[model samples]
Target: MREEKGVIIRTLQEDINNLKIEQASTLHQLSSTLSHLSSTLSQVADLQHEQNALRQELRKEQNQRLTIQEEVNRLKSKGCQCDNSSRNSTLLPHDIQTVKEAITFDLQLEMKQQNDSIMSEMSRMEKDVRDVKAKIRATAMTISGLVSSVSDLQTQIYFSAGTIRDVNKQWKTNEIIVFPHVLANVGGGYDASSGVFTVPKSGVYVLTCFLSTHSSSMYAKLILNGNPVVGITAVTNDVSDVDTGGNAMVSRFQQDDRIWIQFYIGHFLWTMSDASVSTFSGFLL
Candidate 1:
């Protein structure tokens, strides 16, 4: 009986140890699962934050689009001089008819006056046309005299050849030199260096300047007939890459009118200062 009791006590002790080991394993498994769940919760929170940010950005974009749409609607309304509210405004039928009739009456009176004026001008113009044709036919016999006379008036300045005389000088930066004198086809001389291209002709003329600056950061200025046409400027360092060459400007001129080109800021002048008389034959069309 004593041996049996000792054996029973040992069995009880072993069972208690086994139960303790199973409890410890269960605790460890629970800790691992809890850690995994915590990690999953963190990831989910991060996903939620990103989703919130995306929603905010979407809302901002939608607001901007709405603002742009409103501005476009306003501009469209102003351009058309009307809107939905104005179109929907109520008005009495008789009042609307009265306004329409008044407008129609004024339009008819204005149109009748216009027609009468147009008919009178047309009759006068027809008579002038007939007179001009008669004059042309009568002058046909004296065509040489007439041609020479018109040519004298039109050829105030002869720029047919050797009009632009390049000085062959390399114009450097901040240099204001005189251009060479060109013998006038009729009487005077043209000196571009002084910014003066004398028009010897009495008729109208078109003038132009072909100008360019050096590769250095610079801007050109074209002053023709005392009119200023500002050239393009190098805002950035790579501007030279965009436009290696310079700009040009043209202007119409009359007899004895002066034309020239200058620099806005002292820039590197290039090997190009050539001026040509554009046209000197036609009337001021």
Candidate 2:
């Protein structure tokens, strides 16, 4: 009996160790996910900055064009005043014509330069607009994909027992131990009232069971759909002896499959102040 007890203890310890490893892995995955999201947000910020800069440049170009138009209008008004003064004064007709020709030539040259500059700037602006539009579309698609990824990660199935009341209940053979306390029931898979977890999906899952016994030997089994998959025993050699046993297992189950813990032989001693209360928990991989 001692050798068998030793093996059971070792097995339970191994299961707990394995669960710790799995928990670490899950944490690492979450960290990676957060890092990726941060990077994506940074990219989005950069794109927004580029768009703002582009808009500012467009406004600056428009203001420059308006200033050029005002200068052209001022030059035309001065030319018209000069023509009227020449007509009233005693100036030679050929000299007056020469002055008018020079003014007309200067105005034409200024208008051509302004038009060329505007056309070149507009062409460049159009290209920039196209590039920005393409980048915005790409960023939008990336954000959509990230949102879907986050949603998939959010869909998790897990549960844990809450603070169990100290009842000191004596359980007979093959009686189901109902842990009324419920700490968590993500995906609504575990029924605290029934002390049974109904599998929410068809997948591999990790299940754990713990028990604490005082002054009595407790034998229990982790049951799957009414069949025993694993057994745990907590034995006490003296009246004051208190022992605790825990077991964890990774198994695959179909949707709607039931899991619970059953008492084989034992009297459970529990208290509100006790630190080593029995617990049951499970989660999908």
Candidate 3:
């Protein structure tokens, strides 16, 4: 009976040790997960802070650009008016002839000399105005570019997916794909329902689109102003392993140009895992 009790105690002690070991291991895993979560949260906060700073900077630049543009228009309207006013300041002639003819001649000569001096001064002033107008034009072009860049920064848009959940679908050849879910749109240029991004101003842009395939061979292209700027093609045959292809381009766009994607004939885009991880992204370059 004593040996039996000893064996029972030893078994109980071993079970307690095993439980302790499992508890420690579980605690370690929880600690690691918490640490990783904290790091991810910190990174998210930093990204938010950086985005806010960029917004503020863009706003500041846009305001400054507006002020400069207004000045340019105003200066352009006031151009050459100074020269016209100078020409209109010339005095008329007088009607009198008598013993004061000598005095009249002297007065006429003096007036002519003064008028010549004024004309010379006006010419110099006009030259100065020309120089200023040139400077304003150069400044206007520079500021216009800056305004476009900042406006592009302010007018960003990204698409992730559509609202069509689990709907078996196929995009026909030359048909457009509309992403119903918009992740971000700075300006109202991007239409989520139509999946078209309209260019608000003329400038160069960097565009990227990702298309995922499940089983159908697919070829998609980014269409800008009814022309293909970039294209990608992919084919998937296995269900367990999916395939994805993407197209990117740095293309020049004009104002009011509509940008979207079109699938080629005999190709289709598919949904994988009940979620649309496919994305379309772009920014002004």
Scored against the true structure, residue 39 in model 3 reaches a CA lDDT of 58
Instruction: For residues 89-128, write the lDDT of model 2, one tens digit per residue.
Output: 7563536446655766776676668657656766665666
TM-score computed on alpha carbons, candidate 1: 0.32
lDDT of 3 by residue, 89-185 (tens): 5442222223235554555565556556555655655565565456556555655655554444444333233432432576687888777666656
* Highest-scoring model, TM-score: 2
Cα RMSDs, all models: 45.8, 9.2, 27.8
Top-down lDDT ranking = 2, 3, 1
Clashes of 2: 0
Ranking by TM-score: 2, 3, 1
TM-score of each: 0.32, 0.49, 0.44
Stretches off by above 4 angstroms in model 3 are 1-167, 239-241, 266-268, 272-275
What tens-digit string does per-residue lDDT give for candidate 1 at 95-142?
443454465566556555655655565565556556545554544534
Name the regions of candidate 2 deviating beyond 4 angstroms: 1-149, 272-276
